[model samples]
Target: MPKIRQVEIKSCRLETYSSKICVPLPAQNLPELLSVAQKLKELTPDLIEWRADYFSASDPKEIIAALEKLRAVIGDLPLIFTYRDYAEGGFVNLNLELRAAIIESVLKTGLIDLVDLEWQTKVQVREQLLQVARENKVSVILSYHDFQQTPANESIINILKAQQEAGADLAKIAVMPQQRYDVLRFMETVLYFNTHYAEIPVVAISMSPLGMISRMAGSLFGSAITFAVYGKESAPGQIPIEKLRPLLNLMSSP
Candidate 1:
């Protein structure tokens, strides 16, 4: 890759070839969320993704309260607040409006460092949420999830470009890989894009066990972060951080 773009979140940088790991907190309630945080205090990953789609609380007030406590418990660890809707592997049937509201509310809390907003959200709503995220000084990761088979390689780059054009601080895609070649194609696409363009950080994941190598080697090809399981997994193909880290370290070693 020529010169790559960088997006900094706390101490971590989302530039090309950086191996950062994120662990998801997939707890369904405040109590569960807190307990997980306590365990994660020592075994911290680079970023903590609160998969809020799993949250039992629907009210923005309750959600914000939970975040306030989470912030206190975790101290300065950066948080990436995310709520994926059912169309994209989310937990509940939460209408888009409520989802947007909860996200906006979370951004205003000053407790989170970034928010993951799906790329397929209604155009108007997506733009509005982006604006709020900016005004609150929180970075936005414009994300897309394809539970089905991965799309063609060209389509993958197109989706990333669209996300960048839409003002994403980071652009991410997670898709299922039906065959080994699917994972290879996804990695090649990322390498090609990073070679040609110098813009926002990007994340490209190929889901399921067959696609696991893409997660482990993604950074070498320009994908910034690898999602690993902590107490639970927010997505498929994730390995426990304990196991994931050693492999990552070995790969990065001289």
Candidate 2:
């Protein structure tokens, strides 16, 4: 298998790789965000993702204020700031310049531990954002989502490779599954990529109920992170962090 990079972030004891459980905090506005943040503090997720696209605030300053509040509440837990794209199931289809401006503003605050940037973002825009993230020392996750159906094996592997080549700290790919076999296929593709060519850790998911097994057992297949929910799932197939912890522990043991 390709070796893990062994990078460490002191805030959350996060390594460059391994099966770390992450729960998405999907509150719509500042007040509700604080409520969910408090609830998440009592949970055991290794990482927390603030799904900013679900948030209703439009002004960049308000968004940054919300992030600052979230950081204060979460303490040292690693935080992922993600304003998912509308095409990839985000709440709104913000125009390119507006989206970049907001994300860049958040990065400048230096509160977020990681930022999820879509792979399909316009080339110049994506590169500029990547540079901003680097300047702030915020790790980048270049992500691709196929909400419709999982692509062929070659295509899946290709996307992962491209992400690593493009300079992602962690490469993530999430695809939908129509049949039971698609779940296995998705996991197998991740396994092949990690064992053969991966230089960076990967977050692989087979979205929806059919792919839930991948969330529980994906550590074995080389997925470095899994997304779960405390109460509401940010994605279609996410289960509760309470249940995911026990299951993940069981599967990871000797």
Candidate 3:
């Protein structure tokens, strides 16, 4: 089969989202996962994400089944498997073995195109996970989230650089901006990195109403992708993908 062509999002890292607004189907059961994917497909989202920690069964067999069902509906559009753990603002607290098992299983099949791994996982564990993903042609988005406060611009930039050095295809950082200055700092980091680092895509977002501008301004600063909710939200400051679609489209237009 011919490789499916991706959109050319030039101003930033990539161009053109499938234009299908993605909804978060944060469900655990296979049936529930598939149901949400189908709904998002009907709604015409360009992609779908399986918040894997929400899966009803963390067992390998059941997880693979759920993923396969999701891939069926997503077709060629990108699919992201986000197994967010509690330490990083997710609900899952599975042991490293289980976490690694799930990640390896998913990537081994190449069913999902992107995997969301936390930036602070053990180095050995992360190295192994990245190896499996790279071998399987999957991209890793090393993500960091701080609900309390935003880090300094230099720290944020360092975080992105760390992820890239750790073999990530992209670097994503989200924090709570306490004031307008915090927001400005985050934007500056994004803009500077976007202009200086053309090889890697950086996603810099703030997790509050004030941070909404970061999401809206992602393309301008060279963010490869931005997270938006479909039916349910997995994080703070996530605009509905429906609303985000037009916002990004308008931003992309000269």
Please, what is the TM-score per model?
0.97, 0.96, 0.88
Model 2: lowest-lDDT 10 consecutive positions: 8-17
lDDT of 1 by residue, 82-186 (tens): 988888999888998889989888888889999999999999999999999999999999999999999998898899889989999989989999889889888
Off by over 4 Å in 3: 1-23
Q: Once model 1 is optimally superposed onto the true structure by TM-score, how far is the C-alpha of residue 230 displaced, in angstroms? A: 1.5
Residue pairs with backbone overlap in model 2? none
lDDT of 2 by residue, 160-237 (tens): 999999999989999999999999988988898888988888889999988999898866887778998887788998
Weakest lDDT window of 10 consecutive positions for candidate 1:
1-10
lDDT of 3 by residue, 118-231 (tens): 888888988889888889888777998899999877887788767867777767788999999988888777677656543556657788788888777765665656777876
Q: Rate the local accuracy (lDDT) of all candidates.
A: 0.88, 0.87, 0.73
Candidate 2, residue 236: CA error in Å?
0.7
Q: Indicate the worst ten consecutive residues by lDDT in candidate 3.
A: 9-18
Stretches of candidate 2 exceeding 4 Å from the true structure: 11-17
- The deviation in Å at residue 5 for candidate 1 is 2.2
> Better model by TM-score, 1 or 3?
1
**Models, CA RMSD each:** 1.1, 1.3, 4.8
